[model samples]
Target: MIKKVILLGMAVFMTGSIAMAQHGGPRGNKRGMAKDLTPAQLATLQTKKMTLALDLTAEQQSEVLRINTEDIEARQAEHEELKQMRLENDQSTNRAEAQFARQKARLDSKIARQEKLKEVLNAQQYAQWKKMNRHLERNRRQPPQ
Candidate 1:
């Protein structure tokens, strides 16, 4: 009877550990994950980068902010609509295909917006911005110390 009880306890403990591991385990450090920036913080970052890169005037800054705000709203709406669609259906091949299409469309829209933003910059500013982006991309690819 004692041996059977010990075996049962071991089985329960093993099952619990497996279940926790499947769902990102207790050892995970969720606190170290990047937190989403607030809208104001995002606006500040955008304005600072645009001002530095494009030498944007007050009027130009306002226009850029308006464009960014519109883009963000549209993206958020698209995300919510996609989430609703996903919730309404169980996972299947068709849903997976639709999700991929939606993600591709989102990426294409972002690229188009980036191109439109380039149109707003002067030739010199655009050249400088491109160089800066290249530097940033290179730095991002390097291994962290």
Candidate 2:
């Protein structure tokens, strides 16, 4: 009877493990932002969020919306390019291709956004925006608890 109970418990444990493995992890289940939402909708959502965060004026909000639209389009293009790269099997398992110059384009894009934001926002708003960006970057880099 004890042996039967032990075997039953082992079978239940094995079944549970198989079920969880088949379900996959959060990262595997997640959809890309570009895939999940339209660019125009994304831009509008971002613009409204920025407006609330920065207390933007009507003119500032309109400018920010334009910027957000451009940003969303560019990001979508980048996403497509990345997908193409993956489809082409372009990424080599080499330190040369892995290190250096990889993030240069992304950083340049960020710098452009910073410059544009500086031109669009007042000093206080620009500072707040930078702080918010830093906070978001920090959160993105952190592992989930």
Candidate 3:
């Protein structure tokens, strides 16, 4: 009877282990881990003054705001699509490709935005803006430790 009980317990334990393994983790929900931002939302967040650090005249500010809003929406849409591709692909190579594409697009967009911003600034204002952007970039790059 004791031997039979031991065997039954072992079978139950094995079945539970197999079930857990197939289900993956306690939560078992992929939706929570997926990227959720729409392009419009990301653009709105990006155009906010805290991140841009530019000093502008009223006209310059309006122009910059328009540029930022447009750029952010475009980039955010591209980013969201890339993120969806990454999530759908299980292969590391595919994920890497998606990431690379997303990064390239982002860099190109940033360069384009910089050029547009230049058209909106005088020499002194542009210099100040560059300085502020450099400071912001430096701050962003620091390791949290």
lDDT of 1 by residue, 1-145 (tens): 9999999999999999998886567765342331365444566666678797778878778767776766766776786787777687656658668879988988898787778778777778768878877797898899643
Could you tell me every candidate's TM-score relative to the true structure? 0.55, 0.72, 0.57
Worst 10 residues of 1 by lDDT: 29-38
lDDT per residue, candidate 2, 3-111, as tens digits?
Answer: 9999999999999888767656434443454468888888888889999999999999888888888887987787787777778887566646644454677788788
Instruction: Report lDDT per candidate.
Output: 0.74, 0.82, 0.71
**Clash count per candidate:** 0, 0, 0
| lDDT minimum window of 10 residues, candidate 2 | 25-34
- Give the residue spans of candidate 2 off by over 4 A: 1-34, 91-95, 98-102
CA error at residue 131 for candidate 1, angstroms: 3.6
- Per-residue lDDT for 1-145 in model 3, tens only? 9999999999999998888777664566443443475545544554456235555567776677688778866865785676776687646566567679778878898899889988998887778878878987997799632
Candidate RMSDs in order: 9.0, 4.7, 10.4
The Cα error of candidate 1 at residue 95, in Å, is 3.6
Give the Cα error of residue 74 in candidate 3, in Å.
2.1
